[model samples]
Target: MTARANTVAVGYLHALLDYARARGLALDALRAALPFDPSDRDARVPEALGAALFDRAAALLEDDALGLHVGEQVRPGHYGALGFVAMNCERLGEALDALRRYQALVIDLGGVGLKRDEQTCTLSWNPGTDGPYRQLAEFNLAGLVTFARWMAGAWAKPLRIDVMYAAPADTREHTRILGCPLRFAQACYRVVLPIDALDAPLIQPDPAMRELMQRLADQQLRALPRGDDWLTRLRAQIARRLRQPPVELDAVAAALALSSRSLQRRLQAEGLRFSALVEQVRRELAERHLADASLDLADIALLLGYSEQSAFQRAFKRWTGQTPAQWRAAHTEPRN
Candidate 1:
């Protein structure tokens, strides 16, 4: 799974899967669609597919600030070796610096950049190439800030959260997740911290663990494949537009602010067809939606933008060789 540079660590996927299951989601449907063993903690997956799965989880949960929730939930173990490396650093600054270098273990998309002023030391994320990743960017930075607080103590919340996009209609969730006021339509996505927090000692400093985690992280990095930023962005867009049916090539292009012809040319360069990507998104979401027993097949069909239940059934059959009910019955876990 970690063969391609385009892949993401399966730990991230597993976390989302766990989150969904805790919320009473249908785990069987997710497995039937993605077909991965939950026990494979070290597995890697294509970043696009992973992003699509994450997006699908968000849609099903109906939480727009789901990234914030995910970020705030980050514990040292969730990041695997990288988390181990970060948490073991002696100082918060060293932890942040280590995170900047080893982040590829958790995510391959972005890097951390630092800027210091008289009062605040800004930590900004240089996001991988742009698509609709505002939520993800926020999630990553918020998690980093949370880790920093863990090292520096819980009172050390960020002073500011500079988000690039327009302010979401609801700021309450952001306030709760970030524990700070947000600055919308900013130059980019970055968080501000009072400079003194950097020197705070970690609660559990371990130089020996840091060395071990660093070596393990390097080995994991070597095992991952090369990536395509554009392709990941395209797939993420496809996931988002699933709720808005008739997910056509042109519509996807328009959403990304490109012409249809240009979109095709780019996808062709990646050896992808837009139609194929649409099917991939729908198939993934169909499995996700079907996981919620309260959500019948008819409701799922509409969510996937199908005009009718019959059309969705035909497509699901063609894609999986079984009806949604059959797939769910086969994959769903037995009740206790």
Candidate 2:
């Protein structure tokens, strides 16, 4: 399918809006600002619009730590399919695995990353390389910590928390809410927790319920729109259908529910061409495929929609001034 706009599910905002309402903020003003009905839990808005709303809400409430408070208010229901799956997992580690796999069901602002060592494991939210996401970052980290506490216990605190943004004028709330050592202006947003904590059993663990939720989550993930903008959506569609025959303009247009002419027009509007876009997608996918050592050159060529290894080699050289094998050799990690 075609890539869709970078959007955030409205359900994620429910906690923030409800938190505002609880604090005596009027609903009418915010409701009027939204393009869709606030009660339409399945609705989504552009990522930029979501950020604007957060800024506006902070102004209206006159609270700088609004994002943290809103995150504190998040319930399992706010996370949609991901929440249910996490709730039913056998242990905290399984629940975290569910979160890592299904985070996009809640927000596309960034990805969830987990790193482990013998003593502790670090769970981090890596926001997109570009964007004004300070508040959203705060919300994400806060929500993750809060949800873990809810599932486990109050004592299930992180060893420390790392935030990407600089320290605000007052961090008392940050300390109070996070309940851990805090570091600001860090390179990434993350929380370090004892590995044993992840082994703790969840309060609610249902294997049957987890299975059902996983199926539903998979379907939702497949149906969700692909990316942050139209071009991204288009590129994603191309990548998905690359291995299938005829990854042409018309085929891609039809996949996105657009006509060939309309798709051409949209690309032109962005000062891009359909052929150029396809080539770009190929270049990107080629690099990614090459990173995996198991895939042979012939397999990589076919995956990129090339009919012959020689032709794929020529394109790779033209794109990167190096043969595919050479590129792979340079990038691949050395064997231990």
Candidate 3:
């Protein structure tokens, strides 16, 4: 009914739950009126509940490794129908497609993308919502690599791993589990897949079974309740398109399958304006891009869709009451 019901995969919570149970944590304390059935490991829960669970677990453990441990421990089966669809696909490429297509059944936050070229394939991830769990980006990639090793081959190492976070002081652990060279604080978190891995045959490929799994996944996905928040959808579309110049109202309306007039009226009904949303999305993206040490102020400006660096500077000043460089200097961490 409410946007609060926007779903997240239960596995994220289940991981914390598993660790807590293993350490004799009073699971009952963390089980406050959660929207998902506690007994169903494969269930989807309201996003609020998932966030709450992560908060509680972090408070209890006080260790960053908790999420990393959970990621490594997530068996392919833990993903439920999504995992089933992926594992049953005929080859590594098909498996990746299944994961991308059915990922909504697991988490409503970020979408997955796969781009293949003559030499290699790249898998890019963008977090859906801003939270500590978004930092679980690392864990999510680690889990995929975990699955990659199983589906592709043990020797199916990545060409490189790019993260949005700054490089850890010691990346041996990342290299150990992720099994790849690391690039940190760049554009976003990405996995560069090896070419040989793409066409590698999956051990459990069954085309018929994959079809059956897809049908079941579709049924299950349809059964899940979706968020009724128009604002959330609008914001998501805007954010996804901010990199493109002059994100037109007509384009966004078309993406939502609505007439421009209807989209305008609906946004007005929610006490929002199309121009206001554009500003909000651009501001958020600007702040995020500025944090990446790899990107210069000019590049950040262009990424946020301004044709000129000066125009972007003017807009950034209006949004944050500081020029882009000033904001970066004040808000971003100093390099060692």
Candidate 4:
């Protein structure tokens, strides 16, 4: 896999396929396009492929809400160790916290964020630049809701739902499955709930089992082969925080749970400097956005955290010996 590649557990792929088969949809074409060994249940697949499978299955079944439906079928096994850890967590909050910490074991496409206040809490999904793929985003949000309901009770439901995309033509399935007021075209995708719900006791709260599963999950996290190294992780952190403002050393260090001095030392050990890596990430993202052929140089500059298009233009020239427009003209195909 490439440095930026993201992957998901194979179990999720199987779950989607299983849902498709149950609905009498044939899998021949899907298998041909994105083949995977059905026997390799313990393996991982590219997250892109998983998203594609969701898209293909939705098309084949003619179900716009396919991700939501497939997510409803998620069982503990689908998430691997993290699932069991959540299953044994004493409180709903504990379960979600575990998910936040160890979710990369199941999917590494983006991030899961949790925030709380006195009266309410929000769980948000921040997908990558390539996504907020409508079906995949629904799957992620629906899977969380389904897992929460299974762990807490049938009464469990989000207070409101916020989706990053425009409202679909049909929202009946969303309303039926999510059972909440829905907001669309928001800054991010979120599930909002009463804060008290976080304290609700799970149906099965086994402290001993939770501890055991947590150990296994920690081991799995340490063993993750993709982009787990310090340098790669730092680049990813820089990429994420670029648009959030104050993309400085202290901020990036805090995100990585390292002091600025320590972070600098680590980078030095890798024969790198923090500033250099940040610039590298910006250049990479600039190229990626430029490849779309829809984003103008100014938009790409802002996305890369530039205060001015001129600053980005200068940096791009430094990185690639060409102006942003010049590079785009040479590298990307013109739109029809």
Q: Which 10 residues in a row give candidate 4 its minimum summed lDDT?
A: 265-274
Question: Which candidate tops TM-score?
Answer: 4
**How do the predictions measure up, each by TM-score?**
0.60, 0.65, 0.62, 0.67
What is the Cα-based lDDT of residue 246 in candidate 4? 64
Name the 10 consecutive residues with the lowest summed lDDT in model 1: 125-134
Q: Per-residue lDDT for 151-254 in model 2, tens only?
A: 98753689999877788999998898889999987766778889888778889987768768877998998787763455557878989988875778998999
Model 3 lDDT per residue over 1-336, tens place: 122345767764565567667777777766663556767766776665676666566567665555556666767766778888888876787677667656777776344556656788777654434443533555577777888778778645789987767765656668778877888765555788876677788888866676577779879766866556455577778888877867889999998888999888665433345776677567767866887878998898778877899999998876445798987775556778
Clashes of each: 3, 3, 1, 0
Model 4 misplaced regions, further than 4 Å: 1-4, 228-336
Candidate 3 residue-wise lDDT at 312: 94
The stretch of ten residues in a row with the least summed lDDT in candidate 2 is 125-134
Off by more than 4 A, model 3: 1-6, 29-36, 40-43, 46-48, 132-135, 167-170, 228-336
What are the clashing pairs of model 2?
Answer: 3-233, 4-226, 6-228
For residues 26-73, what per-residue lDDT tens digits would candidate 1 score against the true structure? 876565446566678787765666666666667878888777777777
lDDT of each: 0.70, 0.77, 0.69, 0.77
Candidate structures ordered by TM-score, highest first: 4, 2, 3, 1
Better of 2 and 3 by TM-score: 2
Q: In candidate 2, how many Å is residue 165 off?
A: 1.2
- Expressed as tens digits, the lDDT of each residue in 39-67 for candidate 4 is 68767877777888889888888889999
